[model samples]
Target: MDNNRLPQETLERVTEETDNLMANYNKYVEQLKESYTNAQKERKEFLSSGIEFTKLIESEETEEKILTVYESYKKLLDDRTSLSKNFLSEINSLLSLVDQQLLLLESSYEPKFGIQTQNPRIFKTNKNNPKRLRNPEDADGPQMNGKYCICNGPAYGDMIACDAFHIEIPWFHMECMGLFSAPRGNWLCPNCRPSE
Candidate 1:
């Protein structure tokens, strides 16, 4: 397997799953809003009917009307409870899925961001050499005196000098090139590597 592909794959999967989770969350929110609206409407209707029943206390139909209203209210309460339970269950399940996805992302986080998880190799460079003078006329932009590497960074830490004789900025940070230690043999920078 290619070293680069794993992080890319994990990133794609996480993005897809996040999109799905957002869609599901939006759907759940809409359902909750509709349920709340319906519940409020039912409660208002129930309250108005109760008030009307007070005026009908002297009529013979009062008992039967009150019984009907009571049953309807009870059914509304049961429906609301059921809806709440289902919503909570779904939210819990979604949360669990999110947690799992987070764990997966954490595992691949370093590689995905090109961060080195292992400790960098500590090595010493020769300190006796004098800094080189920059040539303004150089084709690769104004060369910085004493600065080396593709990053144009100052010489410090673990660095490998390219063996290519004609190369400019021969010194390269091993970390910049994802190297743990200096190569056992002559090393070539990307630009100087011969075409395969």
Candidate 2:
């Protein structure tokens, strides 16, 4: 009887799905670049308007004209700030969606791998020197967020890592992770907990 366990077709689908995912990632990257360009343009506009506002404030002009210029300058600044915040929120949402996708991809193969396979070479490495770090650029990126927390909410306070596993991605919030005390040594999240 087929019990919805990892089907043979699941493995086959992984290859195709990965290709599709790559294409989507490339498209999203282009969108990210456009957002960056727009941000730079907005920054320039803000700078120019700020200079104009400064000049207006310094000029020995009528009070009405000064107040009008100040009002317009404030509005422009607020609009730019709001747009920037919205753009950042969209980027964060995209990041969270990608994380969810990765988790789905991993779950699709868990039945076959038995969730205990020690040979998951998720990190690429040099064959000659096995001890060397697999991803040198990982350290340069932003710290991992609690996107995968069991609570499914934004992480609050300081985040911590598990020593039992390499923190390729953080899985919990400091307090929300349910750990009573800070781990002294190796610790594992529920997903990675060894079945004894």
Candidate 3:
């Protein structure tokens, strides 16, 4: 084994490989730490809260609102079930994210839209605002008149989900590109629907 006889190119290649290996090792270790901590916390909370949630399922429940919420979680779980095939490799990350969202819900945290499920939120509603057309029959249609779908009140726009002040018709966010002229395009906030 004559080190001096080794090709200069070969030595350079080994040095480069070593550096790459160290970088990758550092990245993997950081990722592992994050994964471990997040999983530990999420699993603990899920196991406890999920047990309570499950019990509510088996018992005779009368709260329609709670039942609806449970159903949404069931659906979310079902949608993400296929990811379980990847298990610890991928699904855990996604489940942790969903768990966080659910926890925020449990805390009744409101998004920027200020939507509260307990009380009806109204938008664009007033003598000057457009008339309401959120009835089941017109749900799939325009959803409202004068403005995009308010989800509940006239011209409320999508922000009506929680009560808040809103301009009548053509509620446009300046930063948002292009004018929204249909059934509250995808950018419209569903939570913004006026409930009052």
Candidate 4:
């Protein structure tokens, strides 16, 4: 795939989806904050009312006033409990949505840069023409028929076989020649090139 030009539609769709998810996530966070604030406020109210009821009992206030204060305190406590339950339920929903969004994002981008494997190629080896021996003293000797490449290296990595009919050491490593990929049409090794 060309790095310069990715599929524009896919990029745009992923961006738009991510933005939408983020917006929803932020909204949920705001709701959780509001729920927490409301719960705290209810708790404070319940605590204050309990303090008032204790003061009324200690002062030997009228029975009717004491009962009224106690009832109000109980109602505040119930409201606090309900608010807590609602906060927990909203938290669960937010977590579930986050998990789903993660899954969606993973699935969306997996196909773009997923691991891919090519079937290995099996080549037939010739026992009669085994690999040439690599010895320091042999470097000065005449070129061996079994040896290959200008560097006299074994056939490994990316190499291009010369198309010339009567070329010596026909195979050349693409790296040694500073080539990123194979050239178009027939290619000749340095030894086979005609004089300028």
Candidate of highest TM-score: 1
Give the TM-score (vs. native) of candidate 4.
Answer: 0.29
TM-score of each: 0.39, 0.33, 0.27, 0.29
Candidate 2 vs candidate 3, TM-score winner: 2
Model 1 whole-model lDDT (C-alpha atoms)? 0.61
Question: Across residues 122-189, which tens digit of lDDT does each residue of candidate 2 receive?
Answer: 21112243343344344321122325356665423434454454544454555666665556556677
Ranking 2 against 3 by lDDT, winner: 2
lDDT of 4 by residue, 1-196 (tens): 4433344544665567567656666766676676567656656665676577666655545555546655655665566566567656756765665555445444434221111111011111222444443553442222234575678765455556677888656556667667676677667777887879
> Of 3 and 4, which scores higher on TM-score?
4
Enumerate clash totals for all models, in the order shown. Answer: 0, 0, 18, 0
Pick out the ten consecutive residues of candidate 3 with the lowest summed lDDT.
111-120
Query: Clashing pairs in model 1?
Result: none
lDDT of each: 0.61, 0.50, 0.42, 0.54
Candidates 1 and 4 compared by TM-score, better number: 1
**Candidate 3 lDDT for residue 107:** 46
* Error at 93, model 3, angstroms: 27
What TM-score would you give candidate 3 relative to the actual structure?
A: 0.27
List candidate 3 segments past 4 Å from native. 1-6, 54-196
